[model samples]
Target: MIQGPCFQILLLLGVVAVAAADRRPSFSYSAPRASSEESGPAQYNFNWAVNDDSSENDFGHQETRDNDNTKGSYSVQLPDGRLQTVTYYVDGDSGYIADVKYVGEARYPDSDEVRSYTPPRRQYN
Candidate 1:
C-alpha cells in the first residue's frame, strides 16, 4: 500500500465531502415531514450501521409505521457493509421513530446509548 502525497490529498478531500454530506441528511422515507407542525406531516431520519460479522452487504430490517405512508418496512444498506432500519411517523407535522435499531450479530437490538436519537441526529435505540 503506497501512501503517496497525491493519494493522501485525495483521501483527505473524500473524507471532507463525506463528512459534509453526512451532516446534512435527507429523509428517505415516504411520508416526509414538512416544516409546518400544524399542516404538514412530521419528518424524521433514523438509521443504524450493522457491522456485525463484517459482511460485505450492509443492511438492516426495519418497519416504518404509518399505514397511510407510501412504503413500510425497508431493508437499507449504508455506505459500509452495515445494515440499518429507518422508520417514520406523523404527529401533526411532528413525526416520531424508534431510531435506527441496529440488529447486531446477536440477532437482536442493543439498548446502549439509546439517548442519541434526536430530531436531527440519527439516533440508535
Candidate 2:
C-alpha cells in the first residue's frame, strides 16, 4: 500500500487527471458589427392615445424623431376638471424641455359635501 507523502501525491495526481479528462465545451459571444453604409442616425414617429368615458381614463402621447432631435407632447384629463397638457422636445446633447398648461379651472367639493371615513375592527385569530 502507498504510505505517507507518496499516498498524498497519488491522490492529488488522480484528482488532476479526472479534472483534465473533462470534455465540456467552452462558449463565447461577440456582437455583430454594423456595416459602414448602414451607419446613420435613427428616425421614427409614433403616437397613441386612450380615452374611455366609462372608466374616466384620458391620456395620450406622440413623438417624432429625426436624427438626434426629438419632439413630443402628452395630455391628460385631471380629476379637478382640468385638462393638463405637456409639450416637450430634445435636441441632440441639449436635455429635455417642457411647457405645461391647463385648460380649465380646478374645483373642490365644499366641507359639507365631503364625508368622513371609518375603519372596520379586526378580529384576532
Candidate 3:
C-alpha cells in the first residue's frame, strides 16, 4: 500500500488523468431559421465579390429586397478609368426600370437627353 508523499502524488495523477479524459474539442453552429406563418414573410438577400486583378471588363453585382420590390445594381470599370453603375428594380406588376450613372470627376457624353419621338402614320393612296 502507498502512503505519505507517494499516495498524494498517485491521487493527483489519477485526478489529472480523469480530467484530461473528459476534455474534448467541440464546435457548434446554428443555421438560419426558415420563414413560416408565425415568423411572417420570407427574406431575400444576395452578394457577390469580384477580383480586382481582372481586366476592365470585370464587374461586380449586388441584390437586395424591400417589401414587394427587389433591386439589383451592377458596377463596372470603363476604359477611361471611370466607374459606371447601373441599377434596376422590379415590383409586383409595375414592371422593371433601370438607371445609369457615372462616378468620376468627369462624366462621359457630357449630358443625356431622352425625347419621346413618335413617328406619324402614313395613309394609303
Maximum-lDDT candidate = 2
TM-score of each: 0.24, 0.64, 0.42
Q: What ranges in model 2 sit over 4 Å off? A: 2-39, 111-125
118: Cα error in model 1, Å: 37
Tens-place lDDT digits, model 1, residues 33-95? 577555545344444545344334544544443433423344555543245665544444455
Clashes of each: 5, 0, 0
Q: What TM-score would candidate 2 get against the native? A: 0.64
- Residue range 62-104, candidate 2, lDDT tens digits: 9999998999999999977788999999999899999999998
The TM-score obtained by model 3 is 0.42
Candidate 3 lDDT tens digits, 4-93:
998999999999999999999999899987766465454688888565453335578999887778899998877566778999998867
Give me the displacement of residue 34 in model 1, in angstroms: 24
The candidate scoring highest on TM-score is: 2
Query: Local error of candidate 2 at 47, Å?
Result: 0.9
The pairs that clash in candidate 2 are: none
Candidate 3 residues lying further than 4 Å off, grouped into runs, are 1-42, 54-58, 66-68, 105-125
Ranking by lDDT: 2, 3, 1
